[model samples]
Target: MSVHTACPVTTRKTLGQVLVCLGCCCGRTDKGHPPVPVDWLKSEWKRRMLPKKIHLSISGCLGPCDASNVVLILYGQEAIFLGGLHEETHYLALADWATDCDHQGCLVPLPESLEPFRLERFVDEPVAAGAA
Candidate 1:
């Protein structure tokens, strides 16, 4: 529903990050079928034992309906939006990337293969006052 100016988990140093926004625009069914199975995502994250700093949650909406099922890897003020995530391969890639970032204590470079899935350069919009 609203974009976050800053991540809820604010750390002084950059660490592994994954913002899985199963907003209103996403999940269950758009027209007929489901998108981005949320349960699978949660299970996979736990099974992988991803780093502690890896923040993942379902937000209201992140403003890109055309790019449904958005998953973001945040780094400081910048973020990488990966859209149309409906396959196991995509999740595996995400897990690998997160592990790498955790080890590096910073955002790891995304592979060229994943370049196509990238939605756009994400810049968090300022939150409106007295709207909470």
Candidate 2:
């Protein structure tokens, strides 16, 4: 039998926001919430909220108790984290917001409907605190 290796999938541009979407998020919260998805992230990312050269990656567990789907946004200078969002629309919104972002790399203001599940910034790991 011949083994077939799938070709590598590559993008054209180096996405402005390189996110780490953690998969297989185990554990539930006090309010009975499940972990975040491979698409979930720290809801308050400044750069990710805007539309720019954004690249969202879905990876493995990001480490923590409360967060399920952890998103790690990365630019050239800094990085950001997000969590607890498991809906498809939210993912789309995040993607749309990550385009044409400002140099400051701040969280793009989102609609009221998508504000509750924002992530708690990891003080130990400062996010996107570098040159915007």
Candidate 3:
């Protein structure tokens, strides 16, 4: 489930900087139902009229199974992962954050409402995982 697009030659000139990754397993339901929020997110993006530079993608797997419905936002050198977003307010916050980041030239601190959804990527293996 991968789709690639051709970026324009002058991509750097765009101030809209966001890479939204709707990773695999995020939309899965408990009883093998259809995805939860993928369509809704897409609709919100269209409704909000976000910039074209803010690219949206449907990725295969993002290494965090528990954190389904993940959205990866790339601002400057930072990659912010927001998971478990299933509400309209969450979608709105994403747009707001991306717009602010684009104007600010870097990733600003996330709003208080979005703070809990932030996911810290695993850096290293735990020392006590029964590795003996």
Candidate 4:
């Protein structure tokens, strides 16, 4: 999937922000979802000093609970939702993507490797009554 330029949430000029969900279904191995490498991710973020350019928040319940290992990335005017990230390489790619954006001082297209994980979690149209 290609990068989506518009996000229904808000259009704020942020360098970038990453939110990794650790709630209910996301990082819960008991829920049949793969484990999130919390410690490694934190260490990598700190090692790269990404906080200066990219905001990282390991949060609870970013919703869409079925989408385990969810990660929401807001960059510039776009919001990228990625799910099913169950590998170490996925986390590495996240760090690399953040580092690249930090070096560029702006938002950049997500690496091709991560395209498959892109999720269309938001919809422009409201759900019709009684739709499931």
Candidate 1 off by > 4 Å? 1-14, 30-34, 121-132
Model 2 TM-score, all chains together: 0.47
Name the better of 1 and 3 by lDDT: 1
Report lDDT (Cα) of residue 43, candidate 1.
Answer: 77
lDDT for position 70 in model 3: 71
Two-way TM-score contest, 1 vs 3, winner: 1
List model 4 lDDT by residue over 1-132, tens digit each: 556655478543458899999998888998799999999989999999987678889999987777789999986567889999999899899999999988988878899999999889978898999999
Question: What is the number of backbone collisions in each predicted candidate, taken in the order shown?
Answer: 2, 25, 1, 0
**Candidate no. 3 TM-score:** 0.62
Model 3 has an lDDT value of 0.64
| TM-score list, all predictions | 0.69, 0.47, 0.62, 0.82
Candidate 1 shows a clash count of 2
RMSD of each: 6.5, 11.6, 6.8, 6.3
lDDT of 2 by residue, 10-124 (tens): 7565446555544444323344555443324444343355323454555555665366555666755565566666666666666555543444355455545446756656577
- Tell me the RMSD of model 2 versus the true structure: 11.6
Which parts of model 2 have CA positions greater than 4 angstroms off?
A: 1-15, 26-52, 100-115, 124-132
lDDT of 1 by residue, 51-113 (tens): 465665656677776777677777666777877776767777777777777677667788666
